[model samples]
Target: MAYELTDKDLLDLATGAALLGTGGGGDPLIGRLLVEQALADGCKVRVLDPDELDDDMLVIASAMMGAPTVVLEKVPSGREAVAALRRLEDHLGRQADAVIPMECGGLNSMIPLLVAARADLPVVDGDGMGRAFPELQMETFGVYGVPASPLAIADERGHTAIVATGADNHRTEWFARALTIRMGGSAYIAEYPMTGAQVKRTAIPRTLRLALTLGRTLREAKQEHRDPFDALIDALKQTPYEHGQVLFSGKVTDVSRHVSDGFTQGHALIHGLDSTGTMRIEFRNENLLATVDDRVVAIVPDLITLLDADTATPVTTETLRYGMRVRVFGISTPPIMRTAAALDVFGPAAFGLTQPWQPLEEIAN
Candidate 1:
């Protein structure tokens, strides 16, 4: 069923998207605020099922690209993403019929809603990454054969660029990264033009709603004096993520992170709240690996996230600091994302991890 997102729903949506972001995707706070501001200005965003699309309807996935930390300081104008979409349309010679999110985690999930509301177009319920990933090529659209350009990019200042490098999504990333870095480490983009049929066949389904469900579940759990972690784990059993389990619970002891080549790259250590063992988590914008006691418990392209130990609020990678209590959890990726072909693009190796990709279920056991 199709539904319209009201202002009341934004907070839950942001909360869940941040969790699904797996410690990347800019900040959901920024994303929610942008959507709220747009709604206050009288814009209404409607979400449509991918099945509602005509076979030929044109769809564009819109997103923000750059370091999560940079987005916190350099917020978008809420107009740049629409501009990028328009620029892409001009280059493609056809206006978009609908907007879909490039990824469902974090800030990018809401980016499509903002663009759709401002442009008076509906948004597809699905997305490329069921969870957020750091780079453009990591999306299932790219993994499954969608070309990422003639992609369009825009900065807060109104500059727009069209990047086209044939079928090489990787080369597209190189050019886009350099362009984004020059744009002050953050920018809005529209890419992966697809027909409705293609979208239906390729996109991760219903993750926007999944994020909303997660947030609502956690919030209600807390309100009802239930355990948010248990509630969260139960919620995943009913979603595409399939399952989630706690990996560790402790306080951040040390964080070693730095921004380099347009990514927040580094790791953090968490000391047990009731034990002496320490768990280490690594990242490149998104949480990539979770290690404890020299064992690789979770690795990308699985979903690993840190939440506030008590509140279950997601903790983004850039904000991790020494002494904050955090709970680490890992969830399985959708089957499409775990296929051998998908691993070639976003597996641990894709992120330069030496370990082979294993199911989060297998690793947990």
Candidate 2:
């Protein structure tokens, strides 16, 4: 049976989703506001387990794809996201029975809630990537050989494109990125059509509940005047991977950004409070690598999270800026991200470096 979501649930979902975002998902604040508005206007978000989906039911994954920075500067028209989904449905000749979060982190989690409330469809309580990733092909959808093509991309300006291709997911990622750049560096996308069975087999199950639990833990910890990071670390320790370490706690001193090949490329320098060295972070709409004193400390696949030093709130790649005090935390990557195939696809070399990939746990330990 499907479940109904309350405001309390939304809070928890955001918390857990941020932890999983691995430092790349956009901020959940705006998304949470959108959902809150919807709820106030009498929109109720319904959630369903993967088992509740019918075999013949059509399902679509939706998310905002772009520079998380740009998303903040140019607020969404609110309709563009769901409009993209509807356009995809029109092209597919079927209505999506359930909407699923493309990734379980930050804004992506809340996005589906808004989409479900607006579309009046039930949202599957699962996600493609249990965490956030930089590209379209980073999710389990790609691991499962699900194609992201025939995707519908829509902008706040009402520009829309339905791209179809027979190429691989990498090619699809390149194409969608081009379209997104053409649409001013950000757009709402709906792709990866799958059945309930496909969803059940490929998705990170019970993610919504996980998100809620994480969020609630943070909230309750704050209410009790406890260390929020302690709560987060505790919750994460329950998961499979090792919780590496807390490298630094400090304020952002500089953010250098520019457009490179139609993508946002940048680096942030964070001033440390408890350490003698400064932390430098490089990103491509996601934190890709972190270094201290010119030594690489953490890299992608293994999670590198930035949080408000005081409140423990997550800071997205786009929102990272000068003068923002933050804490840096590392978690080992899941086994999938460490695979040879996955590394070739997303490692430093894939991002244009000739350097060999090193596990975060190794460096931190």
Best by TM-score: 1
For candidate 2, the lDDT comes to: 0.80
Question: Whole-model Cα lDDT per candidate?
Answer: 0.92, 0.80
TM-score of each: 0.99, 0.91
Model 1 per-residue lDDT tens digits across residues 135-243: 8999899888889988999999999999999899999999999999999999999999999998998899888899999999989999999999999899999987888
Best by lDDT: 1
Off by over 4 Å in 2: 240-244
Q: Candidate 2: how large is its RMSD?
A: 2.3
Worst 10 residues of 1 by lDDT: 26-35
lDDT value, residue 357 of candidate 1: 81
- Summarize candidate 2's per-residue lDDT along 1-365 as a digit string, tens digits: 67899876777777677867765667787888899888888999999999888887788998988877677787775688899999999999999998999988878888888999989989998887767777888777667767777788899988888878754877878899899988887788898888888888777677787778777877889999998888877876776554646767888999998756545678899978767689998877667788888888888767788888888777777767789999888877666557776676667777775557888778865
